[model samples]
Target chain A: MGLAKRIIPCLDVDDGRVVKGVKFVNIRDAGNPIEIAQRYDEQGADELTFLDITASSDKRETMIHVVEEVAGKVFIPLTVGGGIRKVADIRKMLNAGADKVAINTAAVANPEFVKEAAEKFGSQCIVVAIDAKRVNAPSKALRWEIFTHGGRKETGIDAVQWAAKMVNYGAGELLVTSMDRDGTKSGFDNELNRSISDLVTVPVIASGGVGNLEHLVDGIKEGHCDAVLAASIFHFGEFTVGQAKKHMAARGIEMRID
Target chain B: MNTIAVIDYGMGNLHSVAKAIEHAPGNCKVIVTHAKNEILAADRVVLPGVGAMRDCIGEIKRLELDYIIQEVSKSKPFLGVCVGMQALMEYSAENNGVDCLNILPGHVELFDANMTNAQNERLKIPHMGWNKVTQNSSHPLWQGIPQDSRFYFVHSYYVRTNDNNHEAASTDYGVKFTSAVAHENIFAVQFHPEKSQHLGLKLYDNFIHWDGNR
Candidate 1:
């Protein structure tokens, strides 16, 4: 049996509540993290990722509690990100029922932390999240640059080079978000995804810019992503995880149907 | 009431494993504990592991869990998951090669850097996500789980048994390797049943009902 392409639904949790703003009914009801997670799980989502967008000191405890509460009910793998800086932060998340922890700003701040975290908690549980934006300037040879602090800052590090470095640092997986295409819903930045996917040997999860099932199909087929992570599309009831799987299946893509 | 003790060596996600067992259809009481007495008293034992082999063995040896696992595995129905299954082997090439429990006749090998699947596609390392497991033996764990049922796996290394008789299942990832191993009272899998949806849950259910004799 071949490895099935993963379709992940991402939830942006701000201050213990799921962030709203995506055009959909009961967006208020979707605020309940547990309910949203349960719905996705029931719909047969391959996995779930919760990014704590709050990234505040006070909200850390709340986020941990949210992870614990959601993890208690959801049987699938849960990946928690945002505000994770040190190994201690990763430990707290794991102890709180997170199967894997995604590090972003911290990895950019201290490149060695990736290796340290991978060493302490096995590379399998450490996922390096890279927020990349395409460089429009013609002078730059690299197509993308790594951004941090929720895409508010750029590190000037070549995106492809950084991807290779993280793998060298023992990162087992990569969650790459294309800021250029994120929230746009036009489609996944296939060029950026393909570049990073080609540079790294680990599984690359294509995040951002998914408006429909076709976008997801593009992410896996053209971009060569191991998985696809979308927010608004799944969060606003644009498409169910089952519907996405059906589309991928019809396209001759291997997926876990059950 | 029968108790299923999930061994916690401070390495992997013990709660998730315990939660799955708690949800399994049975009258069994699922306990997540590192206590020697509790583990020894349980009707069945589950060794759930993740993380590097060195740290896993470090904690296992430090807590004297290695002795307990070896002791309980012989008498009761024992199940191992991921690194837990790998730890039972003689040695692992991970972390520049480390010695394992040697309970099973095999050694863990890392997926080759240049590994390619039958389709000649360059396979990704760690081999994450769901893949079908082809059962090779008539073990009780395969009772309800369909043939070639998908199971969730996340590992860069795979096991190579010295004897094919102990190999319960095999899966393809660039190369077909042993995915599940069964020898006498023990049944172990490389996949995380806790994360593998309904099909995975069925394996756990079968484990709870399985007699140690098989």
Candidate 2:
């Protein structure tokens, strides 16, 4: 009886609809947020994260409604990320029933925003999302730089140092995504995850690449993440959240298997 | 009809908590309110909170909820969650030591910064995510919920009752801490039952029908 490493299924929502193809044979509606959320909840997903990728501000209200609908049915922690820019944005999502909101570019634009959000809304409900890619440094030492705008724009900030700074700024949790391995079906950047996980006292959620259940296990075992967040594998019906938990538990990783 | 009043002192989000209670297999109405009369009139009261202990206590006092909470807890079935559980303690080490409601005889302490598990790996603060909670004593809230059920937890500090008899459950996270407490009509937990899925909803259902008796 101990703390179980979590397996979070992330749904990338674009204008209120789930962006990925959730090819679950049983699920009739693929893009419906509530159905997808309920499916994950039934599969024993420890938590659900909805990353709002909608580009237009006018359609952002759709994400809020999606959250409201999902939170009503799915009885688990829900985290909404992607476009959180200010304190009001955080409040709106929380009011919409999101357990936490992930702040990315805004924290980079003004690091004080993270501090202010944490102060106003409490650190427990604030998550800092970091998109990092490996950088070619002069020395042989491993170095990764922070990227914003969905890993498109580079900030030139050191990822590890920025992680520690965010924790100092009162971020309750850090969602570290590896840009290099993301979308590659490769495993997470264990080295990148371990560096930040070891440096910060807060829980580090390993995100990005996760092709199979083994990648999820590696996230906890090798990456030293407190939780593993994956998008494609779970959304594509390649593996269920229950299957991943069972596999992780079989691999000697503590999992909350129902 | 039984009503569950979720004391909302302008802290963290209470929607999920209220929604969870309403979703439970009960016909009760759950209202999130800071109004003392509404809370006192309800048969069950739930104190749901998050964030720092200082702010929780500060807001409770500023709203003059201290008296209301003390008054209702003595006679009604009350449940405290996360920082709400910590707030019932005498004091807390968070925010450089802040005093609490003292409704429960205990103190809240931060997880040791240098603490490690048996693997010698450093344990993270804010011990986030799901953890198995071992029921120390049987209570109405534990009804139907199996022992050692995993529940969602997200907090940096933990509570320790001055008396062990007050403890209802314990969870291991590098240390065996008091995860839940039961005393008379009051039951509190360090974990977020609202986010614990089915087992969590079961606990809420049990609380709804619990009649403040052993």
Candidate 3:
């Protein structure tokens, strides 16, 4: 395949503290976003995505400064999301040194905004972020629905189908996260990931449910995702990019390992 | 003192390119600036980028680096990485239309969509991660680099050589494309040396000690 399984470590910042527990619970402070990102880069992370979990206009200042600092320290690509509601916000993030902008609530509130941002900045600059949880049965009617507003609100759109449409609206990449599996450390939702990946032409990043290196491998092999994004596993010293890549290489997956 | 002026016109990965160079080999001062004089005085100038060829080449025109670079391209060692390398060509990769550096006698076009896994379900686009490199002929830049060694690559558009003489190295995917090329005083690699590790370090070391005059 043209795609290599990506090992991405996401940073969720709340009032400048990196917190992680179980399923987004027991939320203990992890570390500073900047320090965590720097260490991940050293540990050989393919790319980094930062989400300001407590994103608000007030929190924008802290997020921007953190982005600027991390962008300076890390050389690889960086994607910043959350609190990006206005066109000006996207511009500010780009100017502040973010390579790509991932949007969730704002995009669902106004899908037109994704087109506008993509048109202005180029498709490669916009990432349509989807946080979806499986319905009780995930029947034909409930398959792959979109979850937004920090995974509290549900927009009756099918996550897989929505991903397929987001590309037409001009999103460069797709960040599909599973709310149920997030921080579970149990594993990733390969079936859900595969269903959506099959429906989209754009690169689909598998998020949530990464407990160890094997989960990452399953995310790539079973999910058919271009990249596997995790936060708790990489943040809490579960597995490093190097160690994961070693496992991936053992499985005949090509990775940049020194 | 060898100072490498990293051209900054809001059109490329200027900082990372400079960072990689700084982290590479030999003592050199790396500064990202639009200052033409800094470029004029520096021992070497790097025109590096990771954006569209259109945006990058446009900034070069706006900042008037085209003139300074033209002069430096003739005498000193000039290196292009990715879009920087594509710019060395006659014209390639204009998202809106055709606007290019026209340095080398070649063109860069989008990867044949057939090559993308989305299309053929075969080779990937934005060819991410490490892949192997195979050298066709000997060049100093390839010195110390091993055979069948892998390097990091992340791009869809590649420089298609119209003149074979400019071709230096090649990498394989489903099909082989130009990975490294050199013509006269210019040298560039599609695979990122900065991202590439010890082997990449050897690449930087070779470039630093290289005397392209031969």
Candidate 4:
């Protein structure tokens, strides 16, 4: 069988609780991180990503505790992100039972940190998360620009170029989230996903704007993303992971049926 | 007490591998260790590696786990997972060609970019997620695991054995490639059983009960 496309459920955790919002605003508590993670795992999620949206230094220990609890119960790959600054941060999360750690602001603050972390703790465990917004510039050819601080500020780095550079810096995977479509649930930005996915040899996980199973399919079929990550759809029970898998399989996409 | 020592060369997620073994339906003590004595003394040994082959080989040599692995593989039931499986091969094309343990007669190669499926769609690198693995030959590890069962894989490079006889199972990623191999006391897989859910745990259960004779 060919490689299967993955459906990942993301938990936008804040202050030790899973939260969901509209465009990263108007936050509302969803449930306990551990309970939500266990539910997703039982629902046949291919992978789980927990992003501590708050990223406050004081809440770091709580995040680690959440990771340990979720990992102890869920027997799948768990990716922990948000406020991951240094190699020690990555080490702490991994030791807390996280399979991989995703970094955004820290990597932009110091690109060498990405290279160092990859060298210290294998590129396979290092994921570079990029939050991009479509720039409506008439002069420049670059369509999307990278954003940091939970997609609040723009970094002026071209999204496609930054993705390739991260691969060169030893990023095993790229989690590209479209800020413009995140929380809106219109659909994945297929054009942006295709551009980034085509430039890098590594796997690109298309994140954000997954309104339904069709959006998830587009992420793979058109966007060329290896996997699709969604927060609201799976979080709010708008769609089940099984439904997504069944739809993809019906469309001739190879998925684990058993 | 049946003990399984998971070799830790300061690479990959050894804790997850240890926990998966502990959770597997058996009363076994799973230890993540780098000590040679503990590994040699354990009833079973698991070598789990991740990331680049160059760093993996370097750590294996520096920590002298290479010798320990060779010794342990000869006597006890030895299991290799992911890059641990890749390390058993003679060499890998990763990092511009890095030599491996040479425990098995094979070499690791990168996924060809131009490779496509019957639909002419190019497959992504680091073949991630669940895909069915065709059982090439029946072995003890396949005791409960069904034929053509799905397993979780995450890697850019895959094993290409010189001898097809060692292939226990295969998977199609653009082209058919070896996914699992067995040679006497040694059993290795390019996929991660720990991340694979129930069927993966079944593989671990079978491994724990295996006698290493086949």
| CA RMSD per model (angstroms) | 2.2, 2.8, 3.3, 1.7
Ten residues in a row with the worst lDDT in model 1 chain B? B113-122
* Whole-model Cα lDDT of every candidate shown, in order: 0.89, 0.90, 0.77, 0.89
Off by over 4 Å in 2: A21-30, A137-139
Query: Higher-DockQ candidate among 1 and 3?
Result: 1
| Number of the candidate with higher lDDT, 2 or 4 | 2
Candidate 3 has a TM-score of 0.87
Evaluated with DockQ, which candidate comes out highest? 2
How many clashes in each candidate?
Answer: 0, 0, 5, 0
Question: How close is chain B to the truth by TM-score, in each candidate?
Answer: 0.98, 0.98, 0.91, 0.98
Stretches > 4 Å off in candidate 4:
A138-142
Model 1: how far is B63 from its true place, Å?
Answer: 1.9
Model 3's interface RMSD: 4.2
CA displacement after TM-score superposition, residue B162 of candidate 2 (Å):
0.7
The residue-level lDDT of candidate 3 at A12 comes to 87
How many angstroms is residue A56 displaced in model 1 relative to the true structure, after the best TM-score fit?
3.0
User: What order do you get sorting by lDDT, best first?
Assistant: 2, 1, 4, 3
DockQ of 3: 0.25
